[model samples]
Target: MNTETTNTERSTQIMHTEKQIEFDKIKNIWKNLAITDYAKECIQNTEICLDEVELRNRLRDTTNSKEMIEKLGTPPFQNITEIRDIMAIGQKGDCLTPYQLERVERVLVVVERLRDYLSRGKQFYNSLAYYDENLDALPELREEINMKIRNDGVDDRATDRLFDIRSKMISVEESMKQKAEQTIRNNKECMADTYYTLRNGRVCVPVKKDYRYKIQGSVIDKSSTGSTYFVEPAGVAKQYEELALLKIEEENEVYNILYTLTAMVIYAIPVMEENMRMIEKLDFIFSKGKLSVDLDCVEPQINLERKIELTKARHPLMDKSISVPLDFKIGETERGIVITGPNTGGKTVAIKTVMLNAYMAQCGLHVSCKAANISMNSNYLCDIGDGQNISENLSTYSAHIKNVLEILKEVNKDSFVIMDELGSGTDPAEGMGIATAILEELRKSNANFLVTTHYPEVKEYADKTEGIINARMTFDKETLKPTYRMVIGEAGESCAFYIADRLGMPKEMLENAVTAAYGKGAISNYKFKNDNLKKKEVKNVIIKKRKYHKDTKLSTLYTIGDSVMVFPDKKIGIVCEPVNEKGVLRVQVADKKIYINHKRVKLLVKSEELYPEDYDFSIVFDSVENRKIKHDLDRKYTDEVYHYDIEK
Candidate 1:
């Protein structure tokens, strides 16, 4: 998939569907197994196996083995990638630690046991028949490491000399303890306490501070109060040094053994990696099978027809007992679906259900439905939420548009798209127009898409469009509630006023709203006249003429060259002529002349009030160049000014 579609799927929350919930549940189950990080990655990136044979094989394996695997209990597997890395290094002749070698032994032992267990059923179970027993279990290597390294990570009796050294060290330590005890008894009077202790890995006697000279030993540690001395007697100091040297030799011997064992395992790295991979694949398969059992899901029929038919489908995350089962189909009969309904009527949920199930089926996981027939698509994209980005200065509409634009570029016959509340968050007329155009483009592209909207025009377009069909969420007018049932081939009503009346809104207001929405006859069925009917009817009447105060009359207040502000448009302009009999005035705004309704224009400054009584009116209505030309002409012919003024 392209990054744009991938990002759209994630950002739209289309991937965060019921299947994701199922995926999470399966992940939680695998957590108990403590699988390797490599195995976890394999599981996480598991995609829809488009190959029919491979997909069916996986489903069959899971279905056949889920019970047997559950009875056998979860396999005990530890993440061994680190151990594998150490083995890789050891292959280069580098020494490994005792604990690292022990881990290698443990992993081999587990793999060997798991392999045997799986191979045992190869003849008895079809699921186990896929197990390849020919893969090397590395049994000899495991035994060799086991013999060299103890479970506690200490070197066992692998070398005769190392064993002899440890034995001699233990004997020497016992003798040193006895010597210290005898010394403590001989110096009982000088000792602070009648006990011997080991300090700094050497046997010591706690001697009184004042009698310290009597001990004939070197002080290793002093008591906090300086009342006693922890002394390593000069007599057993040589034995302590010998034991320390023996430990160093033992460590070197253990390292040599570990390095040898690590190298042996490293020789079998290819087989070991293969074995780990097989086990991980098995774990992932069994996990999906276990999830299927838990969710009561069934393997769906996969096809290349670019269609889906779901019967009694429920969102996987919902409570099956109460979740409304939906019968949704697309791609076969119609390439696009336009879902229309009022708010809280399950339109969004229905679209989400289709998207989630399609995704799950494509991912090779059984969907939570009675039966499903799904087709694979190359890309799945959705625009389902208010994708507002404040950092980019994008509003909800802009964000939706941006997503749609990306979708338009990527959509094809093999793509599946789900969009929620298309053409929302803007003016209804233009929003509907943009939504229709998008739908037309999607149809032309031949991609499968599902969209929800409240616009009636969109619903009409869906009805008339060839490849699109209309569906709605059923609403109960009597109960004033949504039934949450999706009914295809129908258009849903908003029922706003009816629901409002049922919610105890004022009846007269609801009646007026209904009449306004539908027609005067919409509420004619009501037997009683509304108490506020006369008042509303009076308010609706249009007056042909308005009585204004003499001072506010437009004809008397406005004159030529007056500055005024026009209503509605709120533009300021200078009046070029007096108000006509029809209450119209000619106004000059900049270089443009416009006719204004006299009543809608408010007089700001009368020409007589702003200028001298004899000021020329041409300057106010003409450009600066024209006024200058007129001024120069008048200077040349002052007598002709009277003639020009008369002609004007």
Candidate 2:
């Protein structure tokens, strides 16, 4: 085959394989971290938690729901279907609605109430509780006593005694009120001056003028502002008065309230936190649930368990019923499996089945296997098939060489590698030589590999190497369809003549070609079968698989609004429409939607993909919104399809 033809075939195979592992439910084991019952219920119901308010508050407070969970513990609130549902009735965006804003105000009100109750618990003897103005009437009391004496209510000696007593009363009252006022003022200032800012090269209160003097002492500079006052320096008398009120008994009451409220709010942290974590998981599940695929007769597995076992798998890209699964195995002694069969004998599909499934499994996706027991090393390398990138100024030969080199770099004694056709871009002698050398290297490396080749050199290697083996996709010449089945230890027999006859090739032309090919030794170059493998047989097998899928009825056929499952894995996707005439169901996952055939759709079985083995999950406490950048390719490349930045 020409290099161009080979490249095209390879690219087609790879594209198909990639499509097989649908991207949306492409195996995210991270989701299992949410192991709590609340999380499981949410996923199972395909319902999101409405815990937006809790999360919003945590975010506003520069905290996360998960953080609180570590300190305080789990939440107490029962799961609400939607925390944001009520808000949903409101408009969305950065701004809040009247009702939403009211909620915020209520939060602030609660804070104020808490502060009030704390203040009321203060003790009479507590320095912080003393009222200063009431304590400053000593002088006035003494004056009143003197005035009474002047009114001639008593003798001169009596008046002197009364005046002395009044003087003493005035002195004591002034001391009490002065000290109480100073302590109260200090507390008020502490609350008021909680925040500050820098302005015009001065450290100033970050409040309005009215609040400034109370919060931060009035500035003494006269040049300061239109509204300015000087606060008298607090003195020793004021300090003594504050000290007199410092009784532990009195202070304890106020501390008790502070401690109680803090404990109450802090205690609710875990529950609130749990709800928030659930909401995040819900968002992810819902977002991912949008894409859906179908599963049917495709059961392809890896031979890690001495025998390969795969069941009910589907092509990720093809409409549901069209994907067929083939089950077979190659042994350890067989280092390489060479698959060959007639044209359209599902040679490509079988090759893709092995390669793509391996890729998906490594990437963490659940495979389309009912029982999958794949034992594979970490490194997965593939040169399945790719068309040459003409735009890259590389020809088929060059692209193949590059791909081979890339694969070789990663291949090791234990690596699993799949190569479609080793070398086919040049002359037959040179091509066979290159293919033979490559096979020799792979065999020597003792790596587990699979390759599809029409070259004699590859077949020869399979015959000679102890660990190498040959497998062929069976083509019943009587049935025109490639049976899509596999057979081990057999060299594939080409049915070219049979195919030509079935397709109604001209008798004279067929005869002439056969003679020419035989004379060229092409007929004897490899095995060829001349028989009738009717198309009807191929069609029947496909129909049978489809019927099996249909008869295996999922509990419900998804409708426009119903939630559905995307497969090869179970993911929540919303059904956008019922099955169309072609048996294809359309669904949306996230922002993307595509039509899938019915065979792949199944009633959501268990809600989760059970983990493979011992797994540890860490709780994630943050949310990140998806970032999408729309690229206008046409606009970006106005002059060319491919642009290279030589200058850069």
Candidate 3:
């Protein structure tokens, strides 16, 4: 398949999964050291294969001879994108400059070196020499270019005539310098500093401005202060002109040599292009080998049968120091696995490890595991994270369902799907039903799938369903912490109360929550009734509420008249009622009243400090005018104004 198609498939397969990020990270490492853009592109487009003998052979060759390969180090492969342009130019009978030809020469040297390196050991690197015949080596071309071009990219001693022309130019220029120096010495009395300098590419003498007419020559330049005049003596003018002409001839000769070399390279473009492809392929292979070594990876055995047996597999992108190694399996006796675990218990990490290793195996790279026996699937699919699309106005559940629909449409018998927290983010009952139905469909198609969930009903379904098994992340009940270990054939219990208690939740509150979830009976008892052993007696058990001892200091912390601010809600209120059995206080804010946990309200004003010994609470609880109106209404109300509002 083409790269676009492969990328689209992988995008859908691991789009919401952690493997998406992990894959990019792996590709980035390869791109960083890649010699050319084409080589980097090859790394990106590498895909898993099932029956590619040549690819496997190359991988084996590199892996087997890694040490020897490392000895050669990285080859000097330069960017050759402009080579195509140069070739096009030469095809139209145009010549290339020395700079362009130098680049081509450098590439040829690299190609020749790589070919020689690989050709050294005929057995180990034999498979990598697939393009050896196509590469011309072009030793003659390399020699000719080296002879004509200097290491600094200028023309060297290539042709005898060009060399002679440069020699004559150098000697004539020296002669001009000597003549100018002699002229300076002869007119030392009229010269400014007795120094000979060059101006306008000709030797000149610095003559004093007052004696400028003493030197009979052309004026070349003058000092900024105008105290001295730079003069090119008439004696050396002809020799300088001859030097310029010789320099022009030298440039022409260099161009001819460059054109000859460029023509030679253009003629061998076909073979050179083939050789470049081979070098890129080799670069890509060695990169994989280097990554394998870096990640402590091992080659996994590929099987036609659908199965994944990963032992001590760790997420390649995670911190190795603290990362938990996963031992997971599928498609042996069971085709579907439902992994139930608490949050942050390595469930997502486990799923990513499986998917990434599978992708790596298919891409012909070694996987990060001690031992792996992975089955080749037609497609690798997953829905492992929040796929929310805010711009599309899609909720997390909608995004998840959209991905599931796409996966369902594309999955086949040889497909592998990994879903994290399946049947979540919606109504528990309906979501569990939908998840069960989807799992049934996947099982019916014989597609290998692994799903993680928090629903008890899903776990029960896995317990009863054929070819489906339940797994869980191990939790330590005493420590109230997850161990991040996956255990098979067991359903995990959600120890919310224990965890909450360890996090400093109130003991009474945790007890009530646990009782509510597990029922009031702390223990179960069996009794026989009606003279039959099968019929059990039913007893009405009453659970007594625990009473708290009222401590004087605690009870007086917030009194009836205390002004307080409710936390989280941030409302100002006065404590109108005493603390209850639950340590919650009833506070009144303006016209509204709310009951808040004692710890959730902060005392702003103490009752003892804010009120008098025999204070009338009505003054603080009600407005002054309302209190006055109540007083008038409570009385006989003899006046008309006070009596008018009594009924209203």
What ranges in model 3 sit over 4 Å off?
A: 1-21, 48-78, 82-85, 121-126, 129-135, 224-227, 500-515, 519-648
Model 2 C-alpha lDDT per residue in residues 1-648, reported as the tens digit of each score = 999997786555444334332222333222343433454443333211123343223222212222222233332222333323423432232322323323322333333332332234243232212212111112332232333323322212334444454455456545544543553455553333333333332223323345444433434333255442323224533433443444332334333432333333243334334434534443332222221112211122333333333444444445545666556454445667877676677766676666555454443233454445444443446665554887899878777877777667657765667777667676555677788788787777767777777765567677777887888877766667777777778878757776776677654444434543333334344333433333322111110111235464442344454445565344556565577666777666555666676655553322122222332211011112111111234345433233321221
lDDT of each: 0.74, 0.46, 0.74
State the lDDT of candidate 3 residue by residue for 464-540, as single tens digits.
99999999988776676678788878877676655765566554444444443444453132111112223234333
Q: Give candidate 2 misplaced runs (Cα > 4 Å).
A: 1-274, 278-308, 311-320, 362-364, 503-648
Scored by Cα lDDT, where does model 1 land?
0.74
Q: Candidate 2: worst 10 consecutive residues by lDDT?
A: 618-627
Pairing residues by index, what is the TM-score of model 1?
0.73
**TM-score, cand. 3 vs. native:** 0.75
Show the colliding residue pairs in model 1: none
> Whole-model lDDT for model 3 versus the true structure?
0.74
Question: Model 3, clash count?
Answer: 2
